[model samples]
Target: MDIKELQAERTGIFRDVYSNKIPKRVPVNLSLTLEFTAGFGNLNMAEAQWNLSLLEDAADKLCQTFYSDSCPFGGSMRYPSYYQTLQSQSFIMGSNGFIQHPEVVGMDVEDYDYLIEKPFDCIVERIIPRQY
Candidate 1:
């Protein structure tokens, strides 16, 4: 089959599954993070994430390693630059290139009354700034 026929077949398989019908066969789908996928290509996760061109090798490796029905080549869900620019206190990049969310106490006990009185205002004005 050509590319369009293959795409249509894949779409039909998913559509059948969603519509409560058995597909032609089980769709061998998988979910993987860019950090994890980078390993298959022997890539530095951090460097590959920032230097987008490096992802071609990873995509090639992913196809070779898995028989998934489909996979997306896209940016990491947690972008390092956004976190760095925002001075994010909650989300930080780990040594492994994965984003980590640490426990944060954005508001003090004394601010409970303020939070109760103006929840949205308090969160937007004080808590988000502290955490992000």
Candidate 2:
């Protein structure tokens, strides 16, 4: 089939699901992480994160390979170096080319009562600075 035909077919599958009707087969939507996409395309994850077009190409390749009905690309790509420069220690890029979330105890055991009392204040003053 041509590109238009392929798109129409994919759209029909989504329409079926949206209209609460079962189509001939279920549509497969693939959610790809940057690390997985980079590995699939044989590209460096750190470099791919900086180059969104390269990341998009990787995502396109994955969608075609997996015959995915829909795959949103570049949604999870983050600039770790930029964040790191900003002194944001929440997310770290490991040597394995994967983004790692380090565990941080934002709230102490005694701080629970304060957090419960002032949820917004706790998030803005306590959590935001620590995490981001």
lDDT of each: 0.82, 0.76
Error of 2 at 121 (Å): 1.8
lDDT over C-alpha atoms for residue 130 of model 2: 71
Per-residue lDDT of candidate 1, residues 1-132 (tens digit): 997998899999999999999999998777777777677778887887677678787887777777677774434688788898999988888888777898888999877999999999999998898987
Per-residue alpha-carbon lDDT of candidate 2 for residues 12-109, written as tens digits (9 for 90 to 100):
99899999999868987767677778888899877876676787677777777775777644357467777778776777888876668788767677
Candidate with the greatest TM-score versus the true structure: 1
Q: Scored by Cα lDDT, where does model 1 land?
A: 0.82
- Inter-residue clash pairs, candidate 2: none
TM-score of each: 0.84, 0.79
RMSD of 2: 2.5
Using alpha carbons, what is the TM-score of model 2?
A: 0.79
Query: In model 2, which runs have C-alpha deviations exceeding 4 angstroms?
Result: 72-77
